[model samples]
Target: MTDSENIKEIKKLGEEIMIGGVRFKSNVLMAPLAGYTCFPFRLMAERLGAGSAYTEMVSADALKYNDKATTKLLYTDAREKLKCVQLLGAVPTVFERAVKSDLIQKFDVIDINMGCPVPNVIKSGEGCSLMDDIPRASKIIESCKRSGKVVSVKCRIGMNPQRIVIEEFARMCESSGADMITVHGRTRNMMYDGEPLYEYIALAKRSVSIPVFANGGIDSKEKAEEMMEKTGADGVMLARYGFENPLAFSLLTGREINDTKLSLILEQIDIAEELFDELYVLTYIKKLASYFMKKQPGTKRYKLDLYKCGKVSELRELCTAIFGSDDNAGLV
Candidate 1:
């Protein structure tokens, strides 16, 4: 078959996926971005065509203790039907408490984050470090499974030394009760700096009994289709590139982004204001513009001007000037 024909086949296969009998509308998942994958971002991704979304990796210990701030990350709206919450912690006891806690009980699926490469997360013996100890990771899965909820795991292929244990690790997760596994195709040491090892992801897909999703370096529709064809993964998860272009999700699924980038920025501003205080909201709008304005000429100057604005009105005026004053451009 030709490349276009292969993409068509992949798109048809991507329509929906079932994991542990829990069905998601599509298989194009939004990988959990620590500070950015909040309710509003998830909502926007879903609106743009993400099949499923994971919460920013929350601390299981925080949830177990009923920490107010941590509880807020569990926030959801009516539109996010296939809600999945990813938890980070090294202890089975913490996970047990989290699964039984009210905050986590609301999610449709529970994901364990064994993929984070951040120093703090790894130093605590959580995140990608778990891949080094399959037994402990298994125990964590078992703990989450006790809730009778669909349990899943997200992990990197290996650690600094690059042992290539993804295939073995995935099988262990499946045997230990993981409904699905997401393999970020880089060793913890490589950390998003290079191309993803598609062969390792393919190994993971072949090794697991349950569903496996391939993540990393999937920045375009072509990359999505390529990963799907190369690894034969059940799904593909979008990360950094999705952060830069929210409409990339819709485009990946062969869907058009009918709205202008300016309108999306405006919508992001509204969502930010609703979810945070004025100062934070202003900062968020500017941060978002940093990505949204990348394709515009004199991008540095635009960002500098946006960063100088102290109030929402200044931000609005700058956006209007940059994107024009058409209010109807918001329609999608």
Candidate 2:
């Protein structure tokens, strides 16, 4: 392909749109992982070209009752311009109040958490457990829509192997006034272990008129491209793979995954330093070092040293020694 053709292909692959007037510049999104996807991490992902980023799932009940820790998860940096907050709860009133709260209004989008398969979430009749009760789930979506923010629902295919109800549930979400829907192709019972069922996601996509984003097991650019082609999804939301490589967005858009790795690590470190103190920076660096070590040679040794380093200066020295220079550390 010619240079112009390559640029066009990249643009096509990284296209964006406005859902309920909220701007999303790319189709690839960073999924909200429980302990990850904090403000600093979201900002780093956005900077690396994720079209959108969501806060890890917050409790609707906790937000309504003013739980300080839960509220903290809702916090965002100024650079997280395309922010979406994900809320998990089965109670209609709590979910309603949480979405209507002034804090939630600060976000560009509000995502309902119906895909999480954790026991705590499922036991409460929230998350994936809601799939068995479409009426209750529909009511929750209706309540969220009343909050006046763009409402989106993220859900798995079903509760177990015998129940793949994504198409029906997705249709219900649309009928309930949800602005968009995200379908993680694994059933609740499958969790993260098995291959995602793309056929189920395709069914959901066909059932909804609003944009449908496919999620689950998208770890590499090749897999991303294949999923989009196979399911005909409007976008793909990435989870664990994003934590391991923030620049997976650029890679999915057909960018050359060369030196961009180091740049993103430094960028994340800078963001962490600005958001918290040196101690937080040290912690983030160690976490990030482990992630990067997965791909680079002798990374296990670097990760061990990173974990042992107590000071930011020590971590910086270790990074310099390993990466040589910081010139090529950003996203491609």
Candidate 3:
């Protein structure tokens, strides 16, 4: 098929995917972003069109210690059909304990985050540092697999542009018992910038028999199609842009989305309020609204006003102003 034809063919209603016998409604999915992908956010993405979404990366260390704050992050509702939690850790024994923790026991899939590029995560011998240490990464995956839950993994192609380990790492994850893998087609040093190396993701896809989801820089329906076409991944996971543009899922996947920004924002507020205290709700919503704020015009003043607003009532008003402003009605 021509490039144009290929793009049109993959429009949203892509194939159903079976990962570890847990079938997803469609191939398109939402990737977890730290401090984002809260239950409400994940819910909105699912409502908008994503087949399933993972929670923000949870620290295995926190789970091991039974940290209240970390447990709070694992909250899920029955509304979400497929619940997945991503764990960030390097130690094999810690993962072994974490998979059995009550905090994440309800989750259907446990995703090991081996691709985080944050400096502190790297310094601690976690995240992308594990890419260079395949033996430890493999052991961690093996430990998590013991949970008897469908275990998956997310990782980068290599440590730097100079080092490409897609083929080797992909094989390791499969042999270590990962049911699926999401390959962010970039090195650790590239962070979130630069075009994702589609060829590398393709290499991983070909190297592994398990399902591989292509991640990184897929911000639009067209990009999702292109990523799938280029990498031959079973599906594409929407990340940064997916957080800000939940509508991308509906647009790409043929999922019906009757809700508007104002309606969804209101729903998120109600849910957030129920799960968190007033101060936490205000701060969390304020941080989340910032992403939406970047999408609207005339947000300069509201962005400044956002930090100062601390009450639920005040946050609702600020969000309404920035997201549901008169001049930006249609944009929302």
Candidate 4:
């Protein structure tokens, strides 16, 4: 099909996706990125047209133990009409306790993390490790589903050179009561360096009756449209691309990015101030700025300076220089 024909087809299937009983407004979802998809970031994506958004993976063990930091990650506001918290860890009892907690009960959906490829997550036997033992993973999903919230799982294609077990794994999750499944096309060993094996995602889509979302390396609107057409997934979840283009969801939906880059950054700073102390706000904003400016022209000369900024004001000044006025240049 031609590009317009492809987009026309996507528009029909990508409008919305239902998981369990929860209905999201759109099918362009923001994936649960480790450090990037916080409250402010979710709000930004939702405003930009993400049908749904997920929290960064919080540790189920941490929530079970009442860790203050983990509790804080559950923060939300009215703007995030459709949001889910992604929890990491392998303990069923711990996950059960977390699901039953009052804090977690606030979310309409609870997503379990079984796709992380980071060594630390693997060493803890929580992420891709779960794929090695489907029985144990099924138990965890059952435990989370007991809370009466819409439960979902995010997993990779396979652990390694093994057969890409996504079709079987997705079926296992559905049988275990997972309302939806997200399949990252890369194997655990590939990390983020390769093309997502869409064939595997397509297999999972065919195997499951529940909603399936395709994730991993969907970095542009064309890719989003193409994935939907190729895999017939219910949705497309964007990760690293979101860090560079917070408005990607809008673009996928054929909407323009409506805010200036400077405006977007300032708005995030405001939300950060409301949620954290000065130290945290500055550190987090700098981290976000690093990703936003990584590919911009003239950044190599001032990247270190931007990193060294200790306050939001200094960061704003640097961004003003790089992005110029809002009327002249936006995040595009």
Best by lDDT: 3
Error of 1 at 288 (Å): 1.8
TM-score of 4: 0.92
TM-score ranking of the models:
3, 4, 1, 2
lDDT of each: 0.81, 0.79, 0.83, 0.81
Model 3, 223-311: lDDT tens digits are 78788877778888888878776777777778766765666677889998988888778877877777766667767787778889867
Evaluated at residue 217, the lDDT of candidate 1 is 93
Give per-residue CA lDDT, model 1, range 1-332, as digits (tens). Answer: 43233332333434777788988777888999887787877888888878788899998988756766786678886767788899999999889998898888888899999989989989999999999998999999999999999998999899965477987899899999999999998999998889898878877877766888889998677788888887778889998777678778777765566767677777877877777778867866776667666654545656678878998878878877765645323221
- CA shift of 129, model 1, Å: 0.4
In candidate 4, residue 163 scores what lDDT?
51
**Quality of model 3 by C-alpha lDDT:** 0.83
Error of 4 at 238 (Å): 0.2
Error of 1 at 127 (Å): 0.3
Supply the TM-score for candidate 2. Answer: 0.89
Error of 1 at 144 (Å): 0.6
Task: Please give the lDDT score at residue 162 for candidate 1.
Answer: 43
Deviation (Å) of 97 in candidate 3: 1.0
Preferred candidate (TM-score higher): 2 or 4: 4
> Which parts of model 4 have CA positions greater than 4 angstroms off?
1-14, 325-328
